[model samples]
Target: MDVNGFQVLPSQVESVRLIFKRHPDIAVEFRAKNQHLRNACMDFLLSLIETMCQSLEDLSNEDLVEADIALTYLKDAGFKVDWLEKKLDIVKDKKEKEQSSLARLQEMEDSLLKLKQHCSDLDALVEKEHEELSDTRTPMSFDDVV
Candidate 1:
């Protein structure tokens, strides 16, 4: 997909070519051995990682399948995936916290609006009652007072 203008939605071959251009390890590895097969392998690993990542820096849980695949592959490759898994957990926590905060904020705003409408309605009722009472109120004369 296109994350931060870094489009990785192209063919695996193109992705491998780009990766090779940027990182020499995959290129050398692929070239040093079963070039055609290693080319696909490197592309697959990178694709899994690209799906797991968000804009190449932040971790995202939006694509857990991708993360799982990448992690499983790396584990099979004898690489430790604990650190990456922990990073994913952190990302998931952050996302949950943000969602909760937004929900709370929305509730507060709705409550405030309701209160304001109630106050306005009360004010209008008071004004109408005052107008009605004034119309029926009798003026006292000086003679009646004496």
Candidate 2:
């Protein structure tokens, strides 16, 4: 128990009790309302997480020193910091995805704009050719149509 930094009641009896050896004052006890072991176990785990979060909440939000203190406390208690690492990894992945999506969207927009400019240029060329052909032709009153 000392090495693991936590201990559970040796056997299942009647009620649930989660006790911290270091902080004996911070403990929770409750009975199973529905007599379902799974629910009882889940509730007990949730309470533990809540207790941990509350302890973290007591740290100052503006100070890195407080954060270091919390980290030291967790490390001393043999808690794994893998959750923090996983969170940073998730944030990095999401940012990368967002940046790539933005780049693709910008590329598509540029291609569309270039296509539009090319179409406009082609339309002007067709108009200019029509005007030149009209000017070069000899004009006669109704004779051209006949």
Least accurate 10 contiguous residues by lDDT in model 1: 25-34
Query: Residue by residue across 6-121, what tens digits does model 1's lDDT show?
Result: 23445654664665455444322122234444444454566665655564335444466556766666555543446556765666666677778979999999999999999999
Model 1 alpha-carbon miss at residue 8, Å: 12
Which stretches of candidate 2 lie above 4 Å from their native place? 1-81, 136-138, 141-146
TM-score of 2: 0.39
Check candidate 2 and list the clashing pairs: none
As for model 2, its CA RMSD to the true structure in angstroms is: 12.5
lDDT of 2 at 134: 94
Write candidate 2's Cα lDDT for 27-122 as tens digits: 233233343543434344434344334432242333334434444444343344445334334544555666689799999999999999999999
* Top lDDT hit: 1
